[model samples]
Target: MARPLKDPTGAELARLNLNVQARFKAAAKAKAQTHGMTLTDYLEGLIAADISDLQAATGIQEALIPKSA
Candidate 1:
């Protein structure tokens, strides 16, 4: 027999209201289902990726700026 999966601990819950076209919503749901992840997990992954990209861009921009003595 296999052990059961453990639930995540200390996770915070958030509520969001999005207004989108029906087709768009359906497409997103289908994509999430294909990846075998809940919609929440898929969205969280996207948000994390965006944050990382933004941080990298910011670091590059800061490095390009000249420093004054």
Candidate 2:
């Protein structure tokens, strides 16, 4: 069986902790009915929209700049 690698660095771990806390807070606020859907759903929707925008922008950029090589 393969063994696990070393733990994350302090800064990386702190960032992860902050992210988790932020999500938890968002979920709690969502539970209070501040937003329409749950935190998970809200994040998913936001991520999907972000990806769509990225794709559209990339396509426009490609059209404006011809591919070389």
Candidate 3:
């Protein structure tokens, strides 16, 4: 099993690193409030949308590609 992060090291600093854009964060917060959902749930839904889009794109690309002999 994975161990927990130890303090007094760089773990706290690492945890502070955020890659999300400011606009996305604000939009997520607003949508979550509108739907009465926690921010985590809103983000999960957003991620699900992204995954679905990726899958659709992949399927379209596959359809366009010729099969190997």
Candidate 4:
């Protein structure tokens, strides 16, 4: 038997407005549905991925900078 999902506790919420076209919004919802994820999950994953990529790039850039004695 599959286990039931646990409810999240003490999670904070934030709200933002997306000025995207209706078609883009629909497409994103459809993509998320196809992957069995809610729209929120899909967006969160995208944001997390972008943060990771930016961090990696920053690390590389820092490494290339010369340190002054």
- lDDT (CA) for every model shown? 0.49, 0.38, 0.47, 0.51
TM-score of each: 0.55, 0.32, 0.38, 0.56
**Predicted structure 4, TM vs. truth:** 0.56
Q: Which ten residues in a row have the lowest lDDT in candidate 3?
A: 60-69
| Tens-digit lDDT track of model 4 for 1-69 | 111132133335456668889998899988766656556556654664567663354332232222220
Deviation (Å) of 63 in candidate 2: 31
State the RMSD for candidate 4: 13.5
3 or 4, greater by TM-score: 4
lDDT winner between candidates 3 and 4: 4
Q: Residue 26, candidate 4: how far off, in angstroms?
A: 0.6
lDDT of 3 by residue, 1-69 (tens): 112233223335233345799998898788676755556545544554667673354332222222221
lDDT tens readout by residue for model 2, 33-63: 4434444434433444567663354332222
lDDT per residue for candidate 1 within 1-69, as digits (tens), equals 111132133335456778989998888777766666555555654564567663354332232222220
Is candidate 1 or 4 superior in lDDT? Answer: 4
Clashes of 1: 0
Global lDDT of model 1:
0.49
Question: Highest lDDT, which number?
Answer: 4
